[model samples]
Target: MGEKQGMKGYKLAIGLAIGAALLLPSAAGAAAAKPSYELEWEGGGQSSGTVIARGGVSYIAAKAIASEAGLAISWDVSKQRAQFDGWNKSFAVRVNSDRGVLDGKNTEIGGKPFVLNGELYLPVRFIVKALDGDNVKWNARTQTVTASGLGGYHARSETHNGLTFTVVTATGELYVTGESGESRKLADLGDTIYGAVKFAFYDSPGGLLHLTVTRNYGEPMIQYRVYTAVLKNGELIREAEAGYFRRFVDNATNGGGQLIVTDGRTLELVDDVTGRVAESYDLVKLGGEEDDYFVEGVGPEYLLIRPNDRGLLMLIDRKTGGKTLLYKELLDKLNQEYAETNDVPYFGDWLRFVRRDGDTLYFRNDAPIQQDNKLYAYKLPE
Candidate 1:
C-alpha cells in the first residue's frame, strides 16, 4: 500500500551483460548480390559494413560491430583470434573457423570468421546473437539489423522486501530472475504476445507475481487478447480466463486484498486473493458514453483515467464522486511538439502514461520517429 509505479511503456536498461548468443541461420542466396548489412541501435547510433558471403552465409567486419555495440575487442595476431569482452561475458572467434568459445564453452558460430583487408570479419548473425541472445532481428528487404538493446523483449527490474527481481517479457517465454541470479521460467505465453505488465504482491507468504500479457492477431489487428497469470515462489498458481479489456489497463491494490479493475464501462473493486467483485460503478452514468475510459492509476482519494481519443485526463474523486479535468494543457503541448515534426495530426496513442512515483506522474510521447525521446514529468496538484 504505498504509491505503486506504473510500468506500461518503460524501456528496460540492459547492456551486453544480460544478452547472450543464439545462432541465426543465414538466408539462402542472400549473398547473390553481395549485399551489405546495416546495424541500427534502437535508441540511437548506426554502423554499416560490407558483407562477405561464404557458401551463402553473410559475415561482416567485427571491429565495426564491437565499437558500435560497446563491446571491448582484443586481437591476437599470433593465434589468429579476436576476443570480445562485455561487462559480464566474453567470447572468442578464430579466423577460418566456425568454432568459437562463448563464456568458456565451445559453440558453433554457424559461419566461419575470416580476415579481409587485415580486419577480422565474423558472421553477422553470430555476432549479434552471441552478444544479445534473443533481442535481434534481420530484415531481408532493407538489409538491416535492428538491435533493440532490450534483450529482444521488454523487461523490468524491481526490488521488494529487500529482494530484487527482474521480469522479462520475452514473447512466449516469460522469465523472472531472482536476486541470486537464478532465473525461473514462469510461463509460455504463446507467440502472439506483444507486451506485458507485471505486479509484484510481496505481502503474500512467498510473494505473488501477476502478469497481464497482451496479444494481437490479424492483418489489420482485428482482435486482441489479454492473458492473466499468477506465480508464487516460481510456481504458477493461477492461469485464469482472458482479461476483460482489449488493452490491459493499470491496476491498484492496497494489500487489504482488494484491486481495482475496469472494462471501459464499469469500474470494479475486486478481491485480489479471491476472484470476486466487491464494488461496481457505472461510469457512463456518472459522465457519458462518449469516452472509452481506462484506468491509468489509483490514488487514495481519486482515480486517474484517460478518456480515450479525448486528448485529456480525468481525475475521479473516489470519496466525493466528483470529477476534475487535469493535464489537458500538457497533452496539447505534446501534441503540438509532435505535430510540428510528424507533419500529421497527433494520434492519441502517441502519448502514453509511464508511471506514477509518489506525488509525481510521468508521461512519454511515443512518436515512432522523433529526435527527443525524453520523459515528461508533472507534479500532482495538492
Candidate 2:
C-alpha cells in the first residue's frame, strides 16, 4: 500500500526489506542487531517496543501487536500457544515454533519467538501481514509500521437500515458504513474528545443527524458546556455558538426537538430560526414547603416539576394554575427502599423513558442486593 503523504508517521518508500531479511540465518546471535519500531495507531496514540532478532527473524511484543492492529489475542501459558483473532481471520502459534497455521495454511514468521520481561513476543512481519493478509506495511529505514484498511477502534455503534454508524473513542471521529462496503468518515471530531458523545438521528425533510457532546469536569459548582451539532450538507456543523447551559434542553423528539434555556426562575424556549426566546415560562409560586424544584419540560398545556426531598413529581397547568401529582407512589417506594432520592417521569411526555417517546417509564432500584429494574406505565393524574 502507498503511504499517505503529509502523515507525520510512516515512510512508504522503504518496505521492510522483507525478502532480504528472510534470507539471513534463522539463529539470532548475541552480536545481532535488534531494534525498536515506533508504533502509531491510526488517527493518533503512539508507543514503541523492541523487536527482538532471533534465528535470523524478527519477534515483537504480543500485546503491542494486538493493540496496534486492534486484534484480540490470548496466550495459553500452559500449552505455549497463542491465538490471534481479528479482521475476520484467526491464527495460532506456539512459542519457539516457526511452523504456525493461519486460516488453515502453514505459515512461517520472520523469526523464532522470544519472551521479554514476562510478555510473549511473536514474529512481527508475519502477524502484520495476517491482518487481512497484507494491508499493513513496515519500513526498515524509518522503523515505522502502518496498518491500513482496518476499521477504527469501534467504541460505539448504531445501525439504521443497512448503514452502521461507529464512533472511535480514542479520537472522537464518527464513521458510517453501508452494506455495499463503502464507508466514509461522518465527522472528524479531532483527538481531544472527553466523555460520552451522543448522536440523535432525524429523518426530516432530508436525513439529519444530531450530535450532543459533553465534557464533565466532575465538580458541582464549575460550569460545563454542552454542544449540539447537526449533519448539514454532508458536514457536521455546530448549531449555535456553544454556550454553557444552566438548564440543558433534553431534546425528546423523534425527529426535531426544541431548545429551552433557563435561569432557574425563567425558562426561555428559543426559536431555532430567530435564535431568540419565542416564549418564556416563569416559575410561579405554588404555595407549599418547597425545598428544591426542577423544571423538567414544558408541554402544550402544562409544565412538569418535581420539588422537595421526597421526589414528588407534579405537573402544573400553565393556563389554569392547577397542580396535579402524577407519580407519587413509585418515587416514594424507591426513595424509601434506598434511603435516597429517586425520580420518575409523569404522563404526556415523550422523555418518560430512554429518550424515546414511550407510554412506559422505568424506575431502577440502586440497592446492590435487590437490583430491581422497575417498569411503570406513564400514568396521568386522576
Candidate 3:
C-alpha cells in the first residue's frame, strides 16, 4: 500500500512550524485570541498546542487536555456536542450550552465549547478536573498543566505468532532485538530519538516487522510512518526499502478529510468511501505521543489495536507507558443486547472501532443505531 502511493522511499521533510488563522465568534462578544501553549510532560517531553481565549478564560484545546490525562474524545455534529471519556467516566457538552451531562450528572461548565481554526476549545481546568480528579496540577508560573498519579501500562505480551520484539533507545540510536537474541540498530530515525518506537508483525508475511513512528516531536499533524523490516535468519538486517508514511492532523481541522497517505505530496488512501454521519459537532485533536508507541511514523496515544478482529481497545499514557482497557465495556454491553434481541446463545463475537471520518469515530459492532447496520456508530462523545 505504501509503495503504490509513493509513501515508500519518501524522505522526511524538514521540521516546519505551520500556522494559519481562522477567526471565530467569541464568547465575550469579541474575536477570540489565539494563544500558543507549551505542554511539559512528566518525562521531560514537550509539545505545543494552539489555545483560544474566551471572556478572559484560557480555553485549552480539549484534545490537548485529554492527551495529558490519557483520555478519548469525540465530536457529534448533529447535536453540536463534544464528548470525552476516561477511566470509567464520560462527559458530553453541547456547543453554546452552559450545562452538560458528566458521568450521568448534570454539571455546569458555565461557558460553552467552541471551535477555532478547526480545533475544539473548552474550559480546560473544568474538563481535566471532571475526568481526572486531583490528577492535574496547574502551574500559574510556568503556565503548564502537569498531570500526576496516573496508572501504569499493562504487561507486554507476545504476538499471536509468538514473536516478541524489543526496542532499546539511546541518545541517537535504537537497538531492536528479538527473543532469539538477534539484535540490530535503526539509526535513520535521527541523531536523537525522542519518542518510543513501536513494532508489530506485517500480517502478510512471516519474519516481516512493521515499524510505526512519529518523528520531530513537532506540529499538529503527526506523521505516522510505516517501515518493513527485512529479516534473514530471523534477524533484521536493514531499514525499510522506502518508508511509507501518513500525515494526520487534528480531526477538528478536517473532520471529513480523506484518510490519505502523503510524502512530500498528499494522496488519498480511501476512495469513494463515506464517513459515518455525526449528530453534533465536537472538534477533536489526534492524540499526541511522547514515550509511547513510535515508528510507522511516531504514532498517536489512542489506537484500536485489531479493531476488526479482537477489537481490544486501549489508550496509552505517554509518560508512564500504561495501557488502559476499554473495549470490554462496549463489547460486553453490545453483545448482550444482541443476544437478548435475537434469542441466540452467547458467542464470543465482538465490536471494534473500525474507522474515522472527520470528528466521528466508527465501529464494527451490532449496536442498534445507524441504519447502515454494519457498524455501530456514535457521535463525537455524548
Candidate 4:
C-alpha cells in the first residue's frame, strides 16, 4: 500500500512538471512577437526598411534622406539580389524566379538612393521598369502617379476645391460626372491632362462648382481671384464673391435648414432659401484664441471642429450653443501613446464621420493612416 501511494504521488508530480514545460515555450513565443515595422521621420525624406530578427520594418518619408546611391537599393532576401526604385513614384518591384530583379521604371526621372533605419531602400519605379516595362507616368501638377502593362490600373487624384488636380488612366475611357447633371469627355481637357477636377462643392451639400479659366491678356501683370459659380443644367450661373478662398474644407446643411460654411476661421451659417449669410461667427474667437480651427464635417445635428494645438475636439450643437466632447479620453490616450507635447495627429481629424448608426459613428479617412507598416483602427469609448 505504501509503495502504490508513493508511485501515485510521483506520477502526479511528473504530470505537473510536463504541463509547465509545455506552457513555457508558448509564453516565450508570445512575448517575442511584435509589430513588423517602425515609422520615423529623420531628415526630410521618407524610406522604409525591413527588420530581420525582430521582423520589424521601418518607413521614413522621401524628404528624410540626405543622398542616394543611384536610387537606393535593397537586397531581395527572398530571391537573393539587389533591387531599386524611385521615391514617391507609384510602382512596386519584386525578385523574379530566375534570381533577377523585376520592376517597372519611370522613364521621366532618374533614380536616387535613400537610407532608412540603417538600411537602403530604392524606389520601385527604377527596378520595376528595368526588369518589366517602361509605361509609367507621374503628374506633379495633379499629384498623381500611374503605371500600365500589368493588367492596366489607374487611380484618380481627388482633393478639396484647389488650384491643382491630377489623375492617372491607361488606354481606357475617362469619365467625368458632375452633380449639376453635366458629363464631359475628360480627354478634351488636354493631351497631357493627368488629374481629377477640383470644384468648390461637388461633395458638399449646397456647394457651388468653381472652375479656373486661364486667359492670356497679353500683359505680364495678370491678376486672378477665386470665384464661386452655381452649376445648373451644365451651365455656370449666379456667381458669388469668395474672398481669397483657398479651398472648401467642409460644408453642410444644418438642422435649421441653413447651409454652414467652415471657411478657415470664419463659420458662415447661410439661409437655405437665399444664398445669404444668416448668422456668421469667427471660430477662432469661440476657441478663445486665433488658433487654426477648421470645420471637419457637419452632421445634421452636430458640427465637428478641430482646434490647432489643443489636441482636443469640440462638437457644437446646431440648434443650441451646447457643446459636447466626442471621445476626449481617446484623444488623450492617443496623445499619451505618441508621447507628444503639443500636437499629435488626431485620428478624428483624419477620419470623416459619415453617419451615426445606432451607437456607432461611421467614418472614413482619405489617406491610409499607418504607424509602422501595420495598420491601426481607432476605437472610441462609449
The true-versus-predicted C-alpha distance at residue 287 of model 4, in Å, is 2.8
For all predicted structures, in order, the TM-scores are 0.37, 0.38, 0.28, 0.32
What does candidate 2's lDDT look like per residue over 1-382, in tens digits? 2345634234332444564466565534423544665544455555566667667566677776576655677778685888876433577888778778887788876566666678888766676666543345567754545444333233556676566666666666667777875668766555644545555554334344544444333344223344344544335433422323222334332212344444334445544443444666654364143333445555555566554234445567767768765444344554444433322321111113322134333434333434446554454333
The superposed Cα distance between candidate 2 and the true structure at residue 124, in angstroms, equals 3.4
**For each predicted model, how many residue pairs clash, with residues at least 3 apart or on different chains?**
4, 6, 32, 31
Candidates sorted on lDDT, descending: 1, 2, 3, 4
lDDT of each: 0.57, 0.52, 0.42, 0.41
Which candidate would rank higher by TM-score, 2 or 3?
2
Ranking by TM-score: 2, 1, 4, 3
Model 1 stretches astray by more than 4 angstroms: 1-60, 63-99, 102-105, 108-174, 178-257, 261-277, 280-286, 294-306, 311-382
Give candidate 4's TM-score.
0.32
Backbone clashes (count) for model 4? 31
The TM-score, computed over Cα atoms with residue i paired to residue i, of candidate 1 is 0.37
Candidate 3 per-residue lDDT, tens place, 1-382, comes to 8675565334322112111122223333343334445544443455556555588566677766676554567877684887876434577888778788887799888577887777777765565456443355555544555443332111112333444443322233444545664545543544434443544443323223333333323343233444334333444433332221232211111112222122211111221123222121110111222111211111222333221112233443333445544444444555554533532222223344556565455667543432244755533331
